[model samples]
Structures are given as structure tokens and as C-alpha cells.
Target: MSARIHKLIVGLTLALPLSCGGSDSDGGGKTAELTPGEKLCKSLQDYVTQCGAATPCDTALVQDCSSIVDLLSEPFMNGVSECINRGEGSMTACLTAGFGALTPTNAHTGLAASFCSECAFGAPGCEGAFFSEDNPDTAILGKAILPFSDSLVSEVSTDCATGLGCAGSFLSCTQGVIAQRAIPESTVQCLVDNLTGQAPPPPAGQETCVVEGSGGAGGMGGTGGNAGSGNASGTGGNSGSGNAGGTGGNAGASGGG
Candidate 1:
């Protein structure tokens, strides 16, 4: 909601370069040794270098990049991975395919591949960064989905201070798109496999819930049936006594025994 956050989102969400037609032209061709994801990652790193050098240490751009890195790293990886697994060429490829699936001829759809690829893999410490930790699976799988900054914008609108909620929404949306556009049922299975390794403690309500009894002592007593016309003698006599206290006093009894 703050102006700073607004500026950050706007900067990150700016229109990105795109390349459609599935050709690896524009110097982004896949190397003989590299997977689609690796190629896309390299392109993203190149974009970041170009962008940073173009601005020469712009604070707003730096801040925006840092915020994006913090908020969207995991989602970017998940979405890209899912896209790769779903048979898309790479993350950029997947974005292109997804946009194509919805609207094939739109110029923006073709351009989205470049835009999303750069955004997804742009951050310094992110998976596709030039100095990133070594992880081939991440690099390849990360190619399957688009960047999730749009989802994050909605989240920031609601809670800008902590941005935790926005982060969660962005991740969830990223994973959801991966499942929807790329892998059909892989997300659930992947999560199940992950949780199987680490046995999480059961949730609070799943363990126990207690209820206390608070009825008065006499509250459970049942009313006696109407007295019969004849004399009655029983072992369990009513406890009522006195004019007011007596229950079913001999109202119908005659002068006889």
C-alpha cells in the first residue's frame, strides 16, 4: 500500500522482452550440452547484467530486485520445475506455451517468454543467477513456468508491511499454475513425497478435545407416572415429603385399607 512498495511492484512488473515461434534465435539458442532450463537461466542472468549495467546501481531497481528475490524464489523454482516436467521446453518455453495456449497470436504472449524468464531467474541469489548454488534439477525444472510477480502484487495490496501473506499467495499461485499448465497431478504427489520424509506433528485439534459435564444433581431425575387408582406398594418410594414436598400424595385413596 505504501508508495515505496508500489514503486517496487511497478518496476518489477514492467514489460519484459519476449521471443515466440519456438526458435532459439536472438542469441538464446540452447547449447549442445545444456538443457532448455539452463539456456533460459543463462539468458536471465544475461538480462540482469544488462539491466543493472544499464541503470548503474539505481537504488529503486536494486530494492525491487531484492524484494522479488525474497518473495518469489521458491515459487519460481516450483513453477519452472513443473513446467519442465510437463514437457515444456523450459521455463520461458512454458510461459510461451501457456500464453499461446490461451492466446496464440498476441504479441505480448510471445514476449511474455522473455519477460517471465528474466523475472523468474533474475535475482542475484535466486536459482538461475550467475553465482547460484549448483543444482541442475532446479535449473531445468525452473524453466517450466513464468514469473509470479503479478500474484504478488495482489498480495502486497492487502498486506504490504510483512508481505508474508503475499509471499504465500505467490508461491501457492506458482505451484497451482505448474500443476494446471504443466504437470497434471504431480504437485500433490510431490508434496506427499516431501511430507513423507519429514513426519510433521499432528495439528492441535486432531489430537484431543474435551467437554465438561455441568448439570445439577437433580437435573437428570425423571417425573413419576400418574398414580394408579388402587393402593400401591413399591420398594422404591418417592422421596417427596410435606404438603408442598410430597409427590403424588394419596389423592385417590378411599377410607378402606
Candidate 2:
């Protein structure tokens, strides 16, 4: 990557915090250092705050306080670095690009929760999410659905951003996780129960995803779920039923043929 990014990655860790006996010497870049995730997240929040570009996917919104911590990890930072290294524009833009869209199976990124709750939830349309008092079920639906982010990441990598974060939703275009039935059925039932009545959707997709996530848990109905999720534990679902079911399940149920 670039020299600046190299400094940011390796050297920043060595830069002592002012609190840790480090001091400002001359007029220069702020002496204190932030980890890669912190740096990227700060840049993202700043971009969202200034730009108001929280549309299809708001890069700054955090559904839970815990997720902010989750968002900052080495792999995720690497993804961010990869995006920047290859000449992507801004932090948020690179995030939208999936470090520049590598996975053909998933598209339209900005899937995961934002790191900055203040900037994200306080933005404009976020009151409808976790803090909602109108219907607690709304949050339930949200929580029920978005865990796709985890399973998706789990299925692909231990890291969240490296997998579904880049894809932008819980539902993959390849139908890998769905076919495998990676998500719990209880979560599916919860989603089905709440989706219709709440009037609002999940804060974002774990299942309902960032760009266009297809809700694939069991509650989509036996026809829907069985059709979509092959319950693939990798190759088992892939060859046995994953792709076949994904393609055939809906059509067979509808019986268009």
C-alpha cells in the first residue's frame, strides 16, 4: 500500500498516547494514534456527519453499542486498508465497495451496523430502530433478522467485514448460508411473527441486509425457507440442494411451470 497507510498501520501502534507520557513536539499531525478500525470508523462517521449520505446503507449507524466494538477488528481493518490501497475514494465509499466489490455472490454493500451510534442513530431516519418506543416488537424484528451478519461472516470467515460486511446483507446471492440453514429456526419464527405488524423493517438486514437481503430463515414459510435455505454445511447443501432448491423452491411452490 501507500507509505501513509503503512505508517498508519504499523507505525501508529508504536506512537504513544499523550496520556502515556507521549508529548507533542512540533506543529504536526496529531500525535496520538488510533487503530485501523478506529481511524476508518472515525473517517466514516465524519463522512456521514458531514455528507448526509445515509441512504441505501448508512455507514455510520450502529444498531447496538456492542457492534461498534465488533466493527473494529484486524480483518475488517485489512478490508478497509485493501479498499484504500487500491485507490478507492473515501472510507464510506470504500466500505460501500466491499474494499471494491470482490465477491460476485454478494453485492450492494454497507450491510453491517455503523460504528458511531451518535452519528448514525441521530442522523435522520434512525429513531425507527432500537430506541423505538412505539412497538418493542420492532426492535425484536430487527434483532431477529440482522444476525445474518454473524452467520454470514461465520460461514465465510471468522471476521464479519471480510464476509457479509462486504456483501451488504445476510442473504447471499449464492444461497450458501440459506441453503445450509445456518440460522436458527427460532430467529426465523420471530422474524415472521413481527415483520407484518411492526410497520417498520429491521434497523438493517442481518437477514433483511444492507442493499437487498432476502429474508431466508424458516418463518419465510416452509415453502420459502426450505426452498431458499438448502441448509448447506458447505458442499452438502451446494451439490445436494442449495442451488437447486434456491432456483427451484420458489418456482415449484408457485408452480409456474
Candidate 3:
């Protein structure tokens, strides 16, 4: 065959799918449009189905998914509302922070410790189930719970920074706010101490130094400093405390006018 004819045949073959509009096996391959809530619910349902198929029959997983969705409905709605209120940038930051906080690596150990103490007051068996090491149900429950927890946290982190109360799932919301602000470990402990009516001891060892500005004193050039730190003094403040420190003027010699 001539080279031009060969190329033309190849092009025709490639164009076949586009002309036919994909496959017919999956009902003509027409994509069905879903509303936002429907789409979200479908995704959740698909995840549960896949997990169930892969793992053992987990009654707890079903219950956990149901409970989490129910518990999180208000919070999720509130989060969406808050995100809309804050504009895209802040909303994106809040969502990113919230998701980051919920990752297995960053899930708050302190908040986990306090789960039973504070969260149990209203969440019924959540504290017990969440804290119990022996519970096989926890894994499924944890996974199911993560979505709502993360959503609540994201909403709270966004809203709270704007001086608004997050409308649902207080524990997750508060944890999220703390995480988003990148609150210091000492400050977390201090808050915990205050909750329990105990005095918080100062952070140990040499006080850490925090450089100021959007990216420290060097702008983007400086390494991102630790969240909260002290200078030469003992008064290290919380990271992202939003408190302005005293501005330092240029140093002068004794002989200078």
C-alpha cells in the first residue's frame, strides 16, 4: 500500500471510537449526570461496596458508614457553606489543612487521648470504640469515620479562623482548627491543661526561635521555621498565634547622632 493510503487507514481506525461515541457494552457509553450530593453518595457507596467485597462481611462497616454520613450531614453542609463564604483561596487552604490533619500520620494523638474525655459526652459509643485497641470493628469504623471527621475539621478550620463557629461535629472541627493553625504542641498541652483546670508547665529545653513574615525574615528564601518559638528571650509564643511582635529597629552605635 502507498504510505499516504497506509496513514489514511490508520487515521480512520483511530477515529472509529470517536465516531461511534465509545462502547455499547456499558449502555451506549453515555455518561449520566449526577447532582453533587448524588455524586458524593455514589462515591461513598462504591467505596463501601469495594471494601466489603475485598474484606470480610463487616456489619460494623455498614453501621459506621451510615452513622458517619448521618452525623456528618450537617457538618458537611456547613463546611460547603463556609467554604463558599470564605472564597476559593481560603476554602482551598481549609480543605487542604483538614485533609492533611486527618491523614494517618498526622491524626492528633492528643485529641485521641481526649476523645473519651470530651467527645464521649455526646457521641455515645464513639469514644469507647475509637479508643479500644482490641476492637476489630475499629478499622472499618475508622475508615468510615474519616470522611465526616475530615469534613468537619475542614469546615471548622475555615470558619473558626474567620471567627465563626463551625456548625457540626465539635471534636473533629476543633481538632481541624488546631491542626490548620499549626498550633504548637506546648500550646495544645496548655489548652488541655486549661480544660482540666491545671496549670501548663513551660515547654522544655532551649527555647526555639521563630522568624517572622510570610516565609520568615527572608521571605521565600528562609526555611519555614518551627510553628512557635522564642528568640533570645523565654517568651516563645504559639505558632500562628496571630499576635504581632514588637518591631525591631536598625541597631545604632553609641556615638551615632
Candidate 4:
């Protein structure tokens, strides 16, 4: 790598520990350890800086000079070293060429998130900046996560819709079977008696029970609850057979006197 690129990468990686909530004391919390992948990422960052500073590089130089750390596996580092030994261009040119090939794609979400987090913490004026927004590493992180987000959202929506439809149908069918079983007339009479017992008795002078429906209880089957007048409706009944059975009890037409 070019000296300038190496310098840039060193600056970034060294700053990362401090930027990512790391304290000076080793005893306080977990001491952060740099991983091989992280080291590679920093190395690639350095290469990009060097190349960008150098003259506009040829596409072939960019393609051939790509770093194993950035483009391929750790094992590819051997091949990368061989290419560097060949000395096709200045270190800056080779670094630039390799850096260009490490274009961000959604497969590297973790990498993209890491870079964004690092930038937000380390880079100036990066607070609240999204991968879509312009920043120092926009080209890198944006290319990685944006396409991934789109595909993931689409997949989740499709899966959720299918699951919801299946669950709703199963619930409806199960409730319908339960409602089909007839209840004994005695059970209904017992429910009515219990309900009336819970209510206050009529006054001694009052012979007939005069049901007075209050405005608050209007359209609520004398349950003394208000039906909401707003755009949002009150929770009245379930969508399945439970609703049908509840409504049938109140409807004189459905329940023969």
C-alpha cells in the first residue's frame, strides 16, 4: 500500500477504539480487540485514500491491483502480495485500483453498519447521517446495505401476509365449530337470572320494570358503555362465530320469544 493510504488506514483504525465507547482504563469494561477482518477493512480504507489522491487510475490497474483483504478471503492475501511484488504501478495506483473494487453491496451488512457506526462516532458532521446521505464512506456503506434493505423488506412483507391469512382462517373455522354446538335452554335462563341478580332491585312502589336506556348506553345493548363516536370504532365483536352468537342473543328476531 502507498504510504499515504497506509497512514489514512492507521488513523481510522486507531481512532475506532476511542470512538466506539472505549475508555482509557483497561479494567473498567471489556477491552476491544481488533479482528483480522477489521484489520483488512482498515487496510482497504487506506488503499482507497492513496488511490484517490493519486492520478486517475486505469480500469485494468484498478482491477488487477485490488487487495485480497478487500476483494477476496484472507488466503488471497498471498496472491495480493505476489501482485504487489510485480510492481505494475506505484503503491498509490495499486492501492487505488484495489480499493475501487471493494464496492459495498448488501451481502456486507455487518461491514456497512460497522463503517457507518465508525463514521458517525469518528468523522465530523456524521451525526444522524444515513447511509443514503452524503458522508466520507457513503460510496462504501450505501452500496452494501441499501439493496439488502429493499430485498429484506419485500421478503418480510410477503411472509407476514401469508402467515396472517392462514392464522385468521384457522381461528375463524375453529370458532365456527364451537358455536355450532347448541346450549341448553336452562343455561340461558340461568345466565339471565344471574345477570338480573347482580343488578339493583326495583323500588318497592315500582311494579313494572321500566328499562331506561341512557344516551351513554345507546346502541350498546344496555351494557352501560358508550359507543365511540370518533373515526375509530369501539371493540364490539370478534370477526368469527363468537360475534354471531353474541349478536343472536340480543336480536329478538333471531331468538324466538
Decide which is better by TM-score, 1 or 2.
Answer: 2
In candidate 3, what are the lDDT values of residues 1-257, reduced to their tens digit?
A: 99999999999999998766655656656678754344334433443343222222122223333332332333342443333233322221222223323333133223433443443443556544653436644332233234344454344434432322322254344544544545444443333232222332223321121112123332222222323223332322233223344333323223312
Off by over 4 Å in 1: 1-131, 135-171, 181-257
Native-vs-model 2 lDDT? 0.36
**For this target, which candidate reaches the highest lDDT against the unseen true structure?**
3
Candidate-wise lDDT, in order: 0.34, 0.36, 0.36, 0.34
Predicted candidate 3, C-alpha RMSD = 21.5
RMSD of each: 28.1, 26.1, 21.5, 36.3
> Model 2: how far is 239 from its true place, Å?
72
Worst 10 residues of 2 by lDDT: 205-214
lDDT score of residue 250 within candidate 1: 34
C-alpha displacement of 124 in model 2, angstroms? 47
lDDT of 4 at 195: 18
Clashes in model 3: which pairs? none
